[model samples]
Target: MQSSSSLFPVALISAERRGDLSEDVYRLKPGNSPDGTVELAVTRLGLAEVAESRGVPVILLHGSFSNRRFWYSPKGLGLGAYLARQGFDVWIPEMRGHGLSRRNRDYAKNRVADYARYDLPAIAAFVREQSGQIPHWIGHSLGGTTLAAALGGQYLGAPAVASVALFGCQVSRTYWPLKIPPVEWGGRFILKRFAQLSGARLKRGPEDEPIGLALESMRWHGLFGRFGDGERDWWKGLAEVDVPLLAVSAAGDRQDPDWACRKLLEQVGSEHRQYLCLGRRQGFSGDFGHVEMLVSKAAQVEVWPLVERWLKDPLTPVTGAQPEVLAVG
Candidate 1:
């Protein structure tokens, strides 16, 4: 039921089979992190029929108010399962205080900075250590923002990652109201009143988000605010990130619009980069909303193949009529 790795403390939770696929859950304790010891639950899925054939690792990150369920469901459905079927060892990590990862000592105080600088690197290191290969990363919404921050801050080096893909991720969206002093103070006051935001009440999802996330966003969009903490400027640091990167934005995603997503892709200094807008114009069935972008049945048919292709070879131009991918190498 439990075990530990040599360097990174990893405890296996359970291992079972779904049809012909193998699913394993493990908890990673990042005791070395300055942020304090917080355990993270990670799920690994692969072929059960193949012997000694754990496919290459690909980490799928969930957005706000979500968990590993965002990428995988109990019925063994979702992108994580799709990749497993495609010969990929898929990994899904639940952020601190989310899903199987219990609330840490500073759960309510956690921020994207903490997630980017510490949790992500810990998860990546564990994945790499276990797989014996560099892993590709894909994050959606807040997950993508965290991945971007991690890359921009140089927390996860290029050597440790094979490639990176972000879905519905951006940080350049400016809310002019947050720039006003009165509004900023008022917003902070209102946010500070609540320890956590109810996801079900807000109709966002099932998991509640720590109010720290809202406060962090408030600061990021505040007057003269940048996407970094006191120690680094993530926006400027992005100019030096040189990994194979792919950014996908949905046309109907007003939360993080396509234009902003494109801008984030432009900010990355990767020579091998790509930008994709999913909509009818781009050969998708319909304009995908923030959540539908990755979770819909259409996405399984049109988008999953492209994801597989990117993981397999980031530079390969997508050749298909159903999904039009814009390559920006």
Candidate 2:
């Protein structure tokens, strides 16, 4: 079914009820991208009882091998749904060939550079045009890395972004072997034979990632390599980002340690920024894992309220929102 929207060119796929919340799924074809090849599925969640105009927009970017389901589940649960019930107009975008976004002829070659330089800006523009306000962005894992790249490269900025929150995102983790040319090239050479890395095969997640992503990662971690594409130095560009920012890390997350996550936050030039360490040692109930940091019941009880508080007021003293034990240290 098709619906009319003065906002953007989107096909209304479904508008169903998830208890007291209204779930509207739209297929957005933003041909403005460089190649005009990707179609994105954006899921909008809002409170059924309230006017959508009353809700501010917040975009959730899911990590690699994931979809809108990362931020929102089918049973009407997840942070996206939680925010919607709290009167936030939540938008979860599935990146190219991920989740509901259909693959392109070159889907196997999609990279973060394309995502930051093109896809994100388009999503931000459409949301801002529709909402009549700058939207806040929240991204977990690889999604957060993409957000950093966009901000660092100047693809997404103040005119479109109200704030940004990165959950368990870090690109500075050092791998000594990848720094060696032979090691890096050899790995990429072997991976070139495959179109995508199987998440199920690796036991990492549910979705598969293109081989291009792996090759890109190897390049960034190569000797003398940095966080940006060959053109821009995204790591250095972080020093220019002035928006309110929050970087969260979980101690139990071995893949992206809290220390590495903190390094990513420290590079940001934002005067209003915070580094939240999620661990029992930090006074949380447990050492949250990468995925558990957001999706677990423990997060719902303790972490979600803190996130809600930050969104409501970016300048509020985070000290008051965190566990009192942190003050002692």
Worst 10 residues of 1 by lDDT: 1-10
Estimate the overall C-alpha local distance difference test score of candidate 1. Answer: 0.88
Error of 1 at 158 (Å): 1.2
Tally clashing residue pairs in candidate 2.
0
Top lDDT prediction, candidate number:
1
lDDT tens readout by residue for model 1, 90-143: 999999888999888877888898888888988888888889999999999999
Cα lDDT of all candidates, in order?
0.88, 0.86
TM-score of each: 0.97, 0.95
Task: Estimate the TM-score for candidate 1.
Answer: 0.97
Which pairs of residues clash in candidate 1, taking residues 3 or more apart in a chain or in different chains? none
lDDT of 2 by residue, 107-152 (tens): 7888999899988987898788767889999999999999999999
Once model 1 is optimally superposed onto the true structure by TM-score, how far is the C-alpha of residue 191 displaced, in angstroms?
1.2
